[model samples]
Target: MTTRWALLSVWDKTGLVEFARGLVELGWKLLSTGGTARVLEEAGLPVTHVQEVTGFPEILDGRVKTLHPRIHAGILARRTPEHLKQLEELGIGTIDLVAVNLYPFRETVARPGVTTEEAIDTIDIGGPAMVRAAAKNHEYVTVIVNPSRYSQVLAQLRERGEVDLFTRRMLAAEAFAHTAAYDAAIALYWQREIYGREHLPSFFFLVGEKIQDLRYGENPHQRAAFYRLPGMGSGTLAGSLKLQGKELSYNNLMDLDAAWNLVREFHDPAVAIIKHTNPCGVALGETPAIAYCKALQADPVSAFGGIVGCNRPVDKEMAQEMVKIFLEAVIAPFFTPEALEVLKAKPQVRLVAAGEGQGEGLSWQVRPVSGGFLVQEPDVYDFAEQELKVVTQRKPTEEELKDLLFAWKVVKHVKSNAIVVAKDGVTLGVGAGQMNRVGAARIALEQAKEKARGAILASDAFFPFADTVEEAAKAGITAIIQPGGSIRDEESIACANKYGLAMVFTGVRHFRH
Candidate 1:
């Protein structure tokens, strides 16, 4: 009678035959149940069936195969005298190693239209029982669940004739984690499927795969890495393809995210130039080349060494204009051969080819804090012209209304206390991350100076007082758009009338922090 016996029962048979053959070659007997035994026997490997050991045939549509006392008693038995005597008296063998994997419950329920019966049938009852039995008695019994760990397990068995204590403990921990994640997925799906709960649950289960290790974090001295959700959509930066230049750093990814998100807000040809996670210049045009040039002209100095995001492909003309100014990176859907030829001259610059922008999908925005993280839904609100309330007596003309909408789109992407002054579909000045709304208005007006005369201004939030409107009047701003939710909304509206400014209240605020 062989003292070292291995039990193999699995739903996923990725590398079962080779693993069984290796154990047999190492002089260890194999014990398996239904599907796994069929696979091993077909491969001409000798395997003892669970029915032969337990004297009970599998019943109930093969659900009662491995849940018998003979199987679990062998795995859970200790090496003590009393345990050994009980197993010996019952004619049960000691199962040293157990290899099992659960059914694909997550994949089954994740399909488009999975029904209750199909999902319920896919859940395994005996697999988790066997895995937990082996994991709990890890001091005496070794466990194997993941196929990736097969080669290492066989190497240890061949080298030492048995798994070492350290390997057994490590595998035990991994087995517990594997079962935990599987159960979490089941709980989440059932809660959504049965109770129709969309809010956050009392408990959260997060699983992530490491994308890459960056050079550093926000600073050079700090270490950082990037992780992606298991099934995230392709619209995100993690799914983007890096076609050229070096690996992205932490700061580069942040700036690229800002630029890419801002550029996607436009339907027409548009370009967004971002620096330090703020839009320095943004514009729209009939062609991508013209858009890039106009965006650069908006704030040429700030555009230097910034990231550029284009909604359309980059052609030779656009590439020509891009090379004249030093930029940190460029991202677009595609690039012509001629454009690539000219752009490749600057090897240090990063070039990314992302696919077309997709509409907003169900996703969560996560931010880490000291202890844990904060999760919220993404901001995908659209400000339509019909939703605007003309608060001032002097309504905006058609042209002013067009520029106001453009400025509104751009200002939403900027940081909190943000302001943007625009005319003719191009930004004249942008003030971002100010302490007060009036301070932001002053900085934007100072930059727009002469350009402020006919430009329309857009603010992310309402003006607490009438001071912002008063300053805009002094700066020659002709029109203004804001959310207008303050207690003194009448005061701001009265000041717009005083300046003869065309003011509209969106009744919605976009505060990005």
Candidate 2:
């Protein structure tokens, strides 16, 4: 009987020994290099070193070990008579199975204070070459890259006495994806090192691992899936842990992200209720319970079945108040034991624990266009105290300034043509995604009703006309905050002065389109 050879080279040694032992018991010879060879031998299994087959010592600090012609010729050879004759002439034996995984490049670069030299050293050259060679000749060779596939491959071999062509093709496809993702990570790391993070690369590469497939997208007919981008730190909606409720839908994720992002803007205990990617209510308080109560009062009708986000842990009192209304989901840094018990009655509500509540600064935001994508830096800019200009004759009082700032933060998270009416650290009403600035202002002012008399209004961008200012005045708004870059800034300022309203221009715009 001919000897069947299985070459194994891996960085992650998970399931390596057990799989190799199973192959040995099935009368196959083990071929490995360096650490993999040592592991197999220590497990009381016979192994053949790659250097022994090539009759050449590994040089260049083991960097040139598996790059030899002897290694590639063995894995790439077909089972044809012509290929077999050439292998015999070169004194090379055909390798039936190849198991190889690349070095931990992603993990190495993700470490804090990781130097460029360390990242370069972690890149695997010969590993990718051998994996690709084996995968290309998968009609005759079986290539495995993922350690989790070891058991499945072993089961097939044990049952059929050989791996099927169908299974081999699937493994080959996975092997190529594994190499592609590894290369993409390396490319991005170098791109950041060569040109700073602020610069955009000529070529863009987006890589993510699928976390789950949703039942549907925005609508029932559309398909959707969730993927977690690698190297993005924890405390993100994608990294959140679900403690209860059904699987998250596409809209659930969108609303949860909006709520979480808005709540993170405040240092005090904050709560935000979001529906359809718009905040229906937002407020800050000394405790989460107080914040939840105030936030719910903004627009109780709109808050129904909305997603809730809290910067602090959900205590017993907060949970009790939350259960009174039907909420789609509630995400917080933590949930007290008493709170968890109180929320148990509403098992349908999603309970997500977002660790630490510290949001990472994202560098870029990518959106799909017709053919390709549009990439831009995230809207992370905030106005400094010096950037604020009192355009109106009457400056905002200390109390009005505080509410203006609060409303400004909330407006930044709202969609374009957004307007927010807030007072006493609580949002009275929010109008988002309107076509015209005045239309958005009317929606917010109408919702605020009598409450608008003492509240301040915030606009995401400069009003193109004085109509929005006039609308705010008609609603009895006391103060207004806007980016103030329009050509008609004088008209809006004059209008505010006429209405006895204080208006401030922030010099920065936060347009969420």
Candidate 3:
């Protein structure tokens, strides 16, 4: 066949110039539009303009570029006798590749004071159109929508003078994902502007590409991978820099996510240790090392192989102590050179830095089901213990109050509907991810074993029924803390009264579901 053609358009200008030059060297004709075309052509790349290719100049302020049948016919037509006849009749070249990234609606919305009009202006119509067309023609065209994929396409092109079928398939998947996410961001934005509501019609769209296959899942037999979601076109966990050894595991990611969330709850120097996707330990201290020590001492047993997150830069002293423990990952805002020297010795531990280096990711949660998924708002509670209310009679003593507050801090990190039992500034037991309220309490009690006798119990939510309160009483739980809003409040109160257990309702639920 004659030299194949490639179309390129992108809002993100990264690596576009060099990418086009490589395409020209590979003997593919590069066709781009407006700024993208200008960017490539000005850089001395042999980029053919869209107007030159389609015989149609951009109209409606460049909104009408690449919407013509000439563009679609080239990408969509398979290499069949009839298709060849039509292509020859119209002198239309086959588009074997399409590299297009949509406009920056997600980024525009993410700005500190971006207006609705500005966000709307950032939504690109023709860009998504071309991406969808190219993706739909996976059998004919290779589509690359991300700058990261530019290198991949170049490598494949250099190796075989063509992208392989598998790479083409994967690229097509990414192209469609790019368009889908673009539409979702636009829909989400319009929904908010028009209806003043965030939730719109459900289409169950999740667009991400696996950046890595993790070392392992939560268990040995299970498998895991990390996918990149274009969260506001901002930095993500997968995008973070790995400062030290080993690939992150499934449990490591879960714990890192947990720790990241908890530490972000406090702006000051804070430390958080996450175990089994729950914060078994958290503390704010004058120094980063002191905070980490306090957090580790909170629940030493549970902290083994746990993930740690710190808002402040981890110092040398903290890094030394961290090396002693078997940690899965250590994520902090930053690490001093001295701290890095200490962490470099432990290759098995994954050291991540916050911001770009640190993978404290954007706030979002997506849980999978058999046929579909359940997407809800993530819990981002930032409350101080002072805001908590004492809703019941018989106030807890100073010691019990300290444990109660600590347990409350820990309970927020547990899966919901959740409950945690603690004493002496350490978690004695944690019950999580149970269906019923009472079942969670029972699990916490059972986990606590004999330790629940004098420990303070903290529930993520109010008891729907009083059975959980009565059950905690049987376990000899002393002070109880919960967010009160249950329908059967009187019954739960009576249950707490029966056992003389001090119960306080903070009027704030810490549900993690």
User: TM-scores across all candidates?
Assistant: 0.86, 0.98, 0.80
Clashes of 2: 0
Could you give candidate 3's per-residue lDDT for residues 1-513 as a string of tens digits? 488888988888899888888888888888888889888878988878888878988998887889988888988888899998998899988888888887788877866789977886787888887788888888878888889899988998899888898888898887776777778777766666766544634554556657788777888888878887655222335556678868777877777767876776555677888878777677767888888887887668888988898878889999988888888898876689999999888888888875533333433466889997766666655567677777566778888988787678778888898988888665667788899978888877887788889888999988888898889999999889998888898898888877888888888888876
Ranked by TM-score from best down, the candidates are 2, 1, 3
lDDT of 2 by residue, 1-513 (tens): 998999999999999999999999889999999999999999999999999998998898889898887889999988999999999998999999999999999999988899988998899999999899999999999999999999999999899989999999999999998899999999998899989898899999898888899999999999999988886645788778899898999999999888888898888999999999899999999999999999999989999999999999899999999999999999998799999999999999999988783557357889999999999998878768767999898999999999999999999999989999999999998899999999999999999999999799999999999999999998999999999999999999999999999999998899999
lDDT of 1 by residue, 1-513 (tens): 555899999888989999999999998899999889999999999999998998999999988988888999999999899999999999888999999999988778867689999988888889999999999999999899998888999999889888999999999998888788788778877777765645676766676557899989999899999876544545667667787887888988899888888988889999999999999899999999999999998999999999999988889999999989789999887788899999988878898877664624335577889999888768778967899999999999999999999999999999989999999999999999999999998888888889999889999999999999999998989999999899999999999999899999898898999
Please report the candidate that would top lDDT against the real structure: 2
| Global lDDT scores for all candidate models | 0.89, 0.93, 0.80
Better of 2 and 3 by lDDT: 2
Candidate 1: which stretches are off by over 4 Å? 1-3, 9-18, 31-44, 48-52, 57-64, 79-82, 140-142, 158-164, 194-198, 312-343, 346-362, 370-373
Whole-model lDDT, model 2 = 0.93
Clashes of each: 0, 0, 3
Q: Rank the candidates by lDDT, best first.
A: 2, 1, 3
Which of 2 and 3 is the better model by TM-score? 2
**Top candidate by TM-score:** 2
